[model samples]
Target chain A: MYEFLTGPMVWISFGIFFIGLIVRGVRYIRGLDWKLDRVTYGENISYGVRGAVRSILFWLFPYGTRSWRKNPWFTLWVFLMHFGILITPIFLLGHNILLKEKLGISLWTLPEAVADTMTVVVIVSVVFLILRRIALPEVRIITNWYDYVLLLIAVSPFLTGFLAYHRVADYYFWLMAHIISGHVLLIAVPLTKLSHFLLFFMTRAQLGMDYGIKRGGMKSKGMAW
Target chain B: MPEGTLCNKKTIDTKEQLQALLADKSGKEYYEQMNDLDVDRKALWGVIQKSLKSRTKTWLEICSHCGLCAESCFYYLANNRDPKQVPSYKIQETLGKLIARKADVDNAFMQKCMDWAYSKCTCCTRCGVYCPFGIDTGIMFSYLRGLLYGQGFVPWEMKIGSGMHRIFRAQMDITTEDWVDTCEWMAEEYEEDWPGLEIPVDKENADIIYTVNAREPKHYPEDIAEAAILFHVAGENWTVPSEGWEETSLAMFAGDWEAAKMQVESVYDAMDRLKPERMVVTECGHAYRATVIEGPYWAGLKTGKTPIDSLHYVEWVAEALRTGKLKIDPSKKIKEPVTYQDSCNYIRNGGLADVAREIMSYIAEDFREMTPNREHNFCCGGGGGLNGIGRYREQRNIGMKVKRDQILGTGAKLVIAPCHNCWDAIRDLEEVYKIGIRWSFLKPLLINMLEVPEHLKPKEE
Candidate 1:
């Protein structure tokens, strides 16, 4: 069970994540008739490209925008949580050790304490997000079971990984649970709201293209000083 | 005198003033008309299905409901940061659910969707600027409006305006004779100041075919006179068509593509007949956007193959000033520190923010800029035909708090709103908020400062 969870299941989850993304991307692209002539203000190809690039940069790094200042707490936690989520998975010493043991290839890994700290930060951020959904009346209205379930899905890998790393329970059992949770997250990434992981940059670029390229004679509102 | 000083004698409760305005006859009419419309669920869903294209579909799929766009909305801010007023929530509650459920919607749900789309949102697109996914909530809401329009559940003003356009070739229902007479009368009024001034109507092969909002002839004839005076002083050859003279497109606002097509086609046909070098839309934001940016596409005319180029009056004035064709006297510039309100269509959507500010600097001696000006400027609570839809008056006026504060912060006695809707919306804000600031259009200000050639100036006046 442990070998299957860590081996076949891992490959299966990776396949699902990548193949799901490809299918979604291809479907979206194929659905669009690329030749549809859009009547725009000014058709400057360079301007559109520049606008798309600008918007991509702005959204990827949203710290300076008005949205950041509006809700600094959400901004700070979200930034930290996203950073931790992306970083801890690839750069953690345990993950790197597994990569080296299995594939004979390894990337640089963070200090054990640092990895553990990041996992804690991510878990705390998810807790705050849940609380926010519950506490804020406005947010509470939009909150559904899916929102809570998604948050749980996001935090499970980190929480179980943290517990397993510290040997909180039966070492083999905890590690297997962590591996299974991570696989579930990987599989879910491309299938759910988690798809924003891949869709964010593309959507931002498309917006830049529409407002910047197709709508001619207009500066990119994203890049406007 | 130091800048940022309030010149008004009294303060008015803008909220109360707005409430009073909404309690008036037009407001009552809007409420009755909105409620009277029949709901056809299948037809409404059909419109939604038809309008759903790649861009809108992607927007629907990608919105994360982060609520980051809430701060960017004036309605959200003005209403004490209500999360329900957040732009995304509006989508979430209405369109999102419909798309999620794939058209299994009932009449009660459709009615709720209509109210949220029409009354709650102005489709301003300001929130789109701040949205992480760059989701244009405006475009999404516009599609929702298109669906609502299909169901024939539009605001009374839009219904009347589009109906008038279909029959009379003008939104305000001005007949050909009335349009021609109004132009002649306005020309005569301007002729009193500059003899030999000609407001040419349908002059064949003119350099410019100038068009105007119907409200100009119906209510603000002086704006027409101001444009004529400026054109005359600049020595440019411009003519207004007797037919299709109205540039405003209430049909576009109503999201009735068929009627919108007719409105644009009429303008194109009129311009094609005149064979003008270009068509110059007057200081109306939506009309300028419709005619210049969106019209050709709606009317199925290819951009390069189109007979006439479309230019906004702001762009035209800017170019005229740039080329020395139109001269302004520095000494005659507006005295009090004046601020400029960037019309959403002109600045954010059209990319004329810099040109507008340059024009403002040239004409106003003391030009103070409002905070978050230009593309980031708050809407005047009258965009997306909200000002025309009297049913949302209280909400619109309450939403004006953000803009009112922006103006008050500048302490500019006069606010120059180049777009007609912005001018009207800001004017209403002034009355309700009792901000005591006067509002003027760019045409009037340009007329005030224009340096008429010695031969054209009234002798010894």
Candidate 2:
């Protein structure tokens, strides 16, 4: 029964997310042709392999090897925290492990600890965001129904997962709920505003390359992979 | 003693300054303070909300609330991220109130919100790039300003900016006679090198008519001399019209469309009479953007009928060099590594980055590039009428650090900025940062690079 519930929810979310995302992506690509080019594209292109390589290295080690000494401590904290929250569960080897093994229902104790800690941090950070949005008049003024919906969507997975892990109410039912939510997020990733996760790094990398060119730097580095 | 002295230089300067102040302020405040004391809050909010609703896209949908914009903004960066100085916060505080009230916010809460956007933001679009949504918060403030403009609530300094924008239709408030006199004086000064040089006014059928910023007449008359010498040496058929010679439009910055339209129309009327092949606007960024691109539509000018060819002065000078219309003595080196400051209006609006480089190459011996240059160049501190409002001095100077760092990164000894506002703002940056990069307009450098004219070639004593 749980398997059946998981299968249909996954299919529904994957369908909506994939098609919706493609429509938005196509619209964005078409919009670029309409904007003023001077504002959009830089004037010159400095050639070649070395510049590309340097840009890639720079993106990986964004602040360089200098650690947090050069920039403010807050930047590193926010950077690490954001990366920690974003990178782990989304890319958790367990997702692949489940898909490969096909019937692993339980998290190993160590992996479970990591997931719980990360979930706590994400929930805390999101709650802080919610509080900040309410306390600040500017953010509050601009907040709309969509913004509230987005926040709820972001917070739901963690809450449901945590409840499922603690085996609240019916254990099998909550486990199925957690599986369904995870599948929904995967389908939503490419389709929703969540695609910003992918686009942000791509745009920032392009900006770095453009910045190098505008500065007349002859050599640079990068590959998106 | 009476008639002739009325046109004397110092008197003209003082009178022009007064006219600038009058048009900028217009005694709206005296009536505003009275309205505040007597009028109903409900009525005033009604007028304010009506104007706010008509805003263009810049204010309404550009910000993604990422707060990266705060890092890029001069005000926010300088203020250590005070949040109030952040462009988004400034808009949210003022426009937010009006929006809230329309959406049913209390009147008492609305007036308090007005304080931030009115006092803090100079409306420079410096942080526009950092926004994920490309929200031009500057346009938001300008829209709010337009709303405030309807409410008869311009700050004292903006009144000065608007006033200068009105009479002169330029940033400075010089009259027709004052402008004509300045041109005549500049021509006479350059006659030492080119004796036949004439600052032709209202010349019929001239190949070009060059329009200059008010700064050319007010503070840097030598720029005018340089342009005259270049024109004479190149044998270009160019003239300056006495009636509509001014190019710098503060109205573009002030968000006053009527004043801006009037400015473009006046210049067009003058250009129509001259029947020049092209009208070349001198090194002022916003002016060129206005006249060449936005002015045509703003003044209801359609092409083919009353058509006049318009090109940036940089383009004209560059084309002259490329076509061998002007011969230069390459032995005359500026002896300094010069970095170019790209004016945003010219690069982003007028699309004249290549022309800037072409003109610079003829003058500078060693031309260095400002990092993130051309269309992506950082704004000089003086845009959006920031220079007009003297009260915002600290934030404007702080805002200039973006350019200061670019100049410093080049390690160039000199910075060549073509636009008058860029020239003025960058000069302040040099002093404020103590970067020691000697700032100059492109015309002055060109004048230095040119060979002496045949008419005034040095004679044996």
Candidate 3:
């Protein structure tokens, strides 16, 4: 079970993630026709393309947009949550060692203490988001039972990884659970709302172009206001 | 239930009875059968499959429900931060889930969606300004409206308004002959004040073809006279197309694309026949949006430009003031503490925010700005054809609280609203809230302030 969880299972998860995202992207392009959807699909790379690049880059940073600026605490947690979850996987010492051993590839790895702390940060941030979902009427109204389930799906890998590293409640069992959760997270990315990781760029870019070219928004000339 | 009359809590008896109410030449208010209406799942899914393009489908898939769009909406703010008013929640609950659970929703569910889409939102796109992903759920709500419209759950006013456009080629019942007559009458009435002033119709090869809102001819003939007076003072070689003179599209508000397309094509046909160098639309926000920005897409014009270049009324008025085509009389300039309403359609959507400021500079001595003015300003709450709808009047009233506060914060005695919808919105706000503020359009102000060219004056006695 452990061998399957860490070996072919990893390849299967990555395969689905990559192939599913490419299919989603190509499908997005096929749905749009320039004449019907107008300038977003047009050849005006001048304003539309520039706006698309700027907007995608702009919203990625902390305090990047007006919306981000308005909710400072939420912004901090979101960035922290994203930074911890996304970066920890790539740079964790154990993951790096596994990658080097299996695929003859490795990047700089974080120290054990730092990796454990980052995993804690991801766990804490997920808790904050869940509490925010419950306490904030605005967030809670749109949230469904499945929203909480998605959150569980997101945080389970980090939680299980922390448990496995701490050698708590049967080390081998936790290690197996962590590997399975990681694979599940990877496989769920393109199939569910976790697709936001891929879609954020696509949506922000399209919206920027839509606003820039059609509504004379964002970086349009003489847009003093 | 459909175009003719509202189902105001009364059960409708028969289709003939509903058609009888619809027979009122002007749209009349009467309850029609809405008791346990059945959802046409086939038709609903048909529209979803055919029209739910990549942009909306992507937005539906990708909106993370972060709730950051709450404060960005005036409806949410005005309703004491009601969680339900949040743009993300509104769109997702109404349309988003519909897509997620397509063809499974019943009539009760769809009707609830229709109310939320029409009444709760103005489709202002202001929330998108704050959305981290720029997911304009307003666009989705519009799609939801199209879906609901297919299900025949539209608001009575919108249904009738689109019908008016379909039947009369205007939101009002006034015919083309009536519009032309009103223009001619206004020209004759104002002729003594400025001799030889005429609302020239169907003039070939004119430099600018001016289009106007039907509400002007239907109610305020003085507005037509005012535009003519301004054009005469500026020496603009402009003509009004007799056939496609009406520019505002309640059809656009109604989500009736066919009627909207038909209405736009009439004006486009005018541009073709008259061959004007430019088309100048009146001081109506949605009219400018419908004809210039969105209309081209509906018309499928490849250039994404109107056949002729088009300018909102403010853009033309600003240029006329800036280039010394028409000078503001310094003595006659407004001395009151005046603030300008940044209409969403023309200012945010149209990108004429600076043009409005330029106009204000030329005319007002004490001009105040709404905090977070121009593109980021709150909507007038009466846009998206909400002002005319009989149902949802209470929600409309509640929604204006934000605008009321914005104006009150400015402490300006008069508010200069350059668009027709803005004009109507603030006017209604004053009537209800008794804000003790006067609202106006640029035409009347320009007429009062312009230094009329000496040669064109009525040759003094």
User: Best candidate, TM-score-wise?
Assistant: 3
The global C-alpha lDDT for each of the candidates, from Candidate 1 onward, is 0.76, 0.60, 0.82
Candidate 1's C-alpha runs over 4 A off are A32-44, A214-225, B1-38, B301-307, B459-461
Model 1 Cα lDDT, one tens digit per residue, B341-430: 888887887777888877876787888999888778888888888887766788889988998999999989899888888998998998
Error of 1 at B330 (Å): 2.2
lDDT-better candidate, 1 vs 2: 1
- Which digits, one per residue and each the tens of the lDDT, describe model 3 over residues A1-225? 888878888889999999999888888878876554555456556767766777787799998776788899899988998999899999988998899999999999888899888889888988999999999999999888778878888899999999988888899988888888888899888998788787888888887777667776532352321
lDDT of candidate 2 at residue B29, scale 0 to 100: 40
TM-score ranking, best first: 3, 1, 2
TM-score, per-candidate, Cα-based = 0.90, 0.67, 0.93
lDDT of 3 by residue, B1-461 (tens): 32333543222234454455467433333323443556767777888888888877887776777899999999999999999899988887878778888778976787789789878999888988788767887777776776776666777777767767777778777888998999899999989989879899899999889999989999998999999888888888999998887788887887788778888999999999999999999999999989998888878887667889899998899889999988988999999899999988888787788888888889989999997788888899998888888788899999998999999999897999988888888999999999899988888888878788777778766
TM-score for chain B of all predictions: 0.90, 0.82, 0.94
* TM-score for chain A, prediction 2: 0.63
Look at candidate 2 and tell me the lDDT of residue B140.
66
